[model samples]
Target: MYQADIAIVGAGMVGLALARSLKEADLSVILIDTTPIAKPLSEQPELRVSAFNAANKQVLEQLGVWQHLDQQRLSAYTQMQVWDQDSFGRIQFSSEEMGTSELGHIIENQSLVNALHHQVSQQPNVQMLPSTRIAKVLAGQSETMLMLDSDEVVSCRLLVGADGANSAIRKYANFPLTFKDYGHTAIVATIKTAAPHGKVARQVFTPTGPLALLPLSDPNLCSIVWSQNSQQADELLALSNSDFAKALQVAIEGDVGEIGVESARMHFPLTMRYARQWLSDGLVIIGDAAHTIHPLAGQGANLGLQDAFALADSLQKLAAEQAAFHQARQLRAFERARKSEAVKMIAAMESFKQLFGGSHPLKKLIRGVGMCTADAIPVIKQRFITQAMGW
Candidate 1:
């Protein structure tokens, strides 16, 4: 039997970050996933990216994972602009108001995963099992056992599910989940604007949905997440790259100037997922396995990172106390805290979605008044910036 003190079922950014954060806990960690541990960094920028706030970045810096990242690939956005295409609702925020150098950094998702993988692999207490699958799991009152497809068994006191929104571990553990379709499909791709992005992130809400133009390392390059109803998304997806670019240019009303689709467009349906129980006897779930929210505000990844950090803290304390037998019960506080945060985030996203979704006259008026009110009040804008910064 192969065993470790803790076994993480997914080797993505969240799982690897958990393992890396436990380096000082003096406990063994084994990470498993069907995919390779470190995905190859492509010559061109990857289409998948995340807007990491200052809090998560500070934690990464503390873990030494930030240093492993290529500085050139990181885009520190100092400003943001949000407006509703159907109305005159517009709000702008700047890092200068918060006395910070950056509001956030838009990093390619794969790049951060590779950085975490690099950092975690070097820790003597951590082990990696890549290209492997768990054929079965048995969670007892005191321990969890993962049976691998290779006919190997892993016995650990605790098992963590970081697989993703459709987590197999969560399924195996029978963790109850609540999910809802957002009725939106997100189209993502790398894009080039006619003019420089000026290190600013911009989002525009249309009658269909919202479009986000996140600045990339290059001034002319950006990554876009365009969410719309499935029907409209399909219509747009059917268009050729050039035509799609033209459609995009018209969507944001040429906010970024002439848009050019620089990469193949890929899309996925948007859904919200929340696991009612984050932990059970000998088993637990975190990250996307626990909760997922809309991409409108770009807080999903940050929430996952927060989960990892919070759980790491709890587990470290448990290790220091030399807890055993009833260790699962000790994690209730951790689960409760993270779950509460997830609920709050989900509610916030839902409010934003409903408030800005359509062309209702009342909603449009509210959005316009709200944005103008926020922009005019320096204190209100500062509070918004602080909240977004996770400060």
Candidate 2:
């Protein structure tokens, strides 16, 4: 049997960050994950990437892992351009307006995971168990026990589920989930553009869905995320590399000039999910394990990171007062704070997805005009930028 103050299931960015945060507070932590730590990053960029906003950067900085990231793989975008393909209305947001050097950074997912893993290795108070699967979870009054596939039992004062959307801990703990399928698939790929990305992120709303060209570290390279209906996604996936590139060029209105596919395309279905309750006695959930929102806003990862920071902050504060490690009252407070914020963001993203995805003429006109109007209003635009910065 293994025991710790807290046992975190899932060693992804959120889980790792929480472990590092807790350990920094002199708490014992056990970090478990089914996937082995990824090998060191190579010159080639990984296909999976995420946009880290100001808040996320702050969390990483606090964890002392931000400096360890490969500088070559980090791309900071200072501007964002969003427009509707059906109308002439467009909106542009710049960091200059907000007195910030950059809005956010685009980084490969593997790079982040690697950095977190490296930091965890340096934390003597944190024990990492990789390639270990949790078979079952038993929640008790004073502690929770996780049964591993290897027939080992790990007990902890508190158990946190940072696992992805389909979280096993959430299931075993009986956290009810509300799920809604977006009926769309997001296709992701890396591409080389004829023109440099100019440190900007571009998103265009097509009749089918939204297509985003996120700036990459390489000025001439960009990461594309195209969300479309099932039929369109399948068709795009079936197209040859050159054909797909051509289609992509037409889709983005060739804003960055011609593009050539630089990597194999991959995709996954889109869904919005939320856990009805985020805490149960000594058990709690964070990150995708608690809620998942549409990728249209690209706030999913940021939200998860915020949850980790919030939870860690709460736990540290409580520990200072000599509170129980898994006091239900404190855990509930953390849940309330994070769940409310997550729900608000998820609702806003859902609204955006529905408004821009509609086919009605009035809605299309409203979408375009609303964007233009928001752009014309400095206060509104600044508010949008501030929100995106995770303020």
- Which numbered prediction scores highest in lDDT against the true structure? 1
Q: Work out the TM-score per prediction.
A: 0.98, 0.97
What's the distance in Å from true for residue 361, model 2? Answer: 2.6
Estimate the lDDT of model 2: 0.89
Candidate 1 residue-wise lDDT at 102: 94
C-alpha root-mean-square deviation, each candidate: 1.1, 1.2
1-391, model 2: which lDDT tens digit per residue?
9999899999998998898777657578999999896567666667788888998898789778899898888999999999998687799999999898999999998898888888888888888899999887777789888899999999999998999899988888788899998889999999999999999999999889999999999999999899998889999999999999999989899899989999989999998899999887788899999998878878888999889989999999888878885977777878888999989988898888888885788988888789999999999998999999988
Off by over 4 Å in 1: none
Model 2 scores worst on lDDT over the 10 consecutive residues at 37-46
Question: lDDT by residue for model 1 over 238-266, one digit each (tens)?
Answer: 99999999998988888879888899999
Local error of candidate 2 at 15, Å? 0.1
Each model's lDDT: 0.91, 0.89
